[model samples]
Target: MLNMQLANKYAKAIFEVAQDDGKIDEYGTDLKTVASEIDAHKELASFLVNPQIQPNAKKDLCAKLFKEELSVSVYNFLMLLIDKRREVLLQEIVREYQTLSNAAQNIIHAEVTVASALNEKQQAKLIEKLEESTGKKVVVRTKIDQSIIGGVVVKIGDRLIDGSIVRQMQSLQKQLMAN
Candidate 1:
């Protein structure tokens, strides 16, 4: 909880800076790249968070790895995290930043589960419907769960819309039992 709070604080500060510079998406891409690189390379992640290593050494390594890829403001932000010994929260900060960026851009993420994979047309239709209903741009992550038997289940944030055959059958069974 404490770590999340700290991450949010850092993310908000950088988000505000990005907003002012009209570079929110660019900064988000940079932060995501940095976080993913660290996650993909365990040794590098350890080195960044290791208290035994000197801050100058860590900053030097970061500069070599990301300076060319990231904008100046983002690169400086990375150095700031090293200076503050908060480099360990890089991934969480990136996530928080993405959440802020998505909200700012009026985009919402949805998880769609179906019995099988959705083809391009179907996926496009689903996104279109979700966008129309929510009045926000929709980004969907699709999953296949054969156990659902048929139909689809969509989850958007705290809301769930379950139209799966399994759920429908359950409802029918309950109604029969009640009758």
Candidate 2:
């Protein structure tokens, strides 16, 4: 709960900074990069969050790791968190920041995976359906996933709409076995 409060504070700060610099898109990409970096390095994440590690050391390490990737404002903001003993909240902060950033800009990202690549007309139609369903501007990223066998799997935020033939076959097999 307290982490959420802190995250909101930091996220708002970042959003404002990005807006002022006209780097909202770049900042969004930067945040995702930072999050991915932390995700890829589990030991580093653990070390950063460990209470036994001195806060100053953590701050230095963070700065060193992200010096090239982060802007001065972002670096100072992260240092501020370290000074406040809130360095452990990076994951929550990143998550909340992304949520707020997306909402602020009315940006939504979705992905559609199908057994084969959709033709241009099919892509447009699928995007139209998503817009009708979501009632928002839909930016659909398309991908080909042959493992799907057939049909499509759509993901919007955390929700998944699976219309895949593989899943349908499994479901059908289950019902038949019960009979």
Best by lDDT: 1
Residue 168 error, candidate 1, Å: 0.8
How well does candidate 2 score on lDDT at residue 58?
85
Candidate 2's displacement at residue 28, Å, is: 1.9
Candidate 2, 176: how far from true, in Å?
Answer: 19
lDDT of 1 by residue, 43-145 (tens): 9998999999999999999999999999999999999999999999999999999999999999999999999999999999999999999999999999999
TM-score of each predicted structure versus truth = 0.97, 0.70
Q: Residues 1-179, candidate 2: write the lDDT tens digits.
A: 87889888888888899889888777777777777887899998888778888988987788889878887777777788778887777778788777877777776778999999899999889888988888777788888999999999999999999999999999999999999
In model 2, the runs with Cα more than 4 Å from the true position are: 111-117, 132-135, 141-179
Q: List per-prediction Cα lDDT, in the order shown.
A: 0.97, 0.83
- Model 1 poorest 10 in a row by lDDT: 117-126
Residue 66 Cα positional deviation in candidate 1, in Å, after optimal superposition: 0.9
So what's the TM-score on candidate 2? Answer: 0.70
